[model samples]
Target: MTEDIKVDKVVDLKGMPCPMPIVKVSKGIKDVEVGQVIEAITTDPGALADFPAWAKTSGNEILKTDQQEGLIKFYIERKA
Candidate 1:
């Protein structure tokens, strides 16, 4: 299901660490409308925690997450 998610925007935070990945996603989410999707690609493991936490805190929705070989992709939908 996640593999087929359509993305309105793509934010690449590769090589960034810690909060930066989530930070970029935070800004990227704003580029899309509510119900639209943004795909955030990052190399930080922190995103495993940060993304979900941010989605909950910011009232956005994480439609899907894909992780492989240290790469992570977040499919987020703006809810608010």
Candidate 2:
């Protein structure tokens, strides 16, 4: 049930470095409505560590994440 999600924003964070992808995606989705989705595609390994931590601290929801061919896709829902 955690594998599927509907996203409102799709951000391509591929090829970005550790904090950059997280920074940009965090900034990018700040204005999204509550419960709106943000999808991030990243190649940085940091996203795997950073996003879950970010979600926990920021109170957002990590809906889903899928990895294929070294690309990571994360679906997040804004909490407030």
After superposition on all CA atoms, what RMSD does each candidate show versus the true structure? 1.1, 1.8
| Candidate 2 TM-score over all chains jointly | 0.89
The prediction achieving the highest TM-score against the true structure is 1
List candidate 1 segments past 4 Å from native.
Answer: none
Top candidate by lDDT: 1
Backbone clashes in model 1, listed as residue pairs: none
Candidate 2 per-residue lDDT, tens place, 1-80, comes to 54457778889988987788878878867968988999889999878899999888888988888888999988889996
Cα displacement (angstroms), candidate 1, residue 18, comes to: 1.6
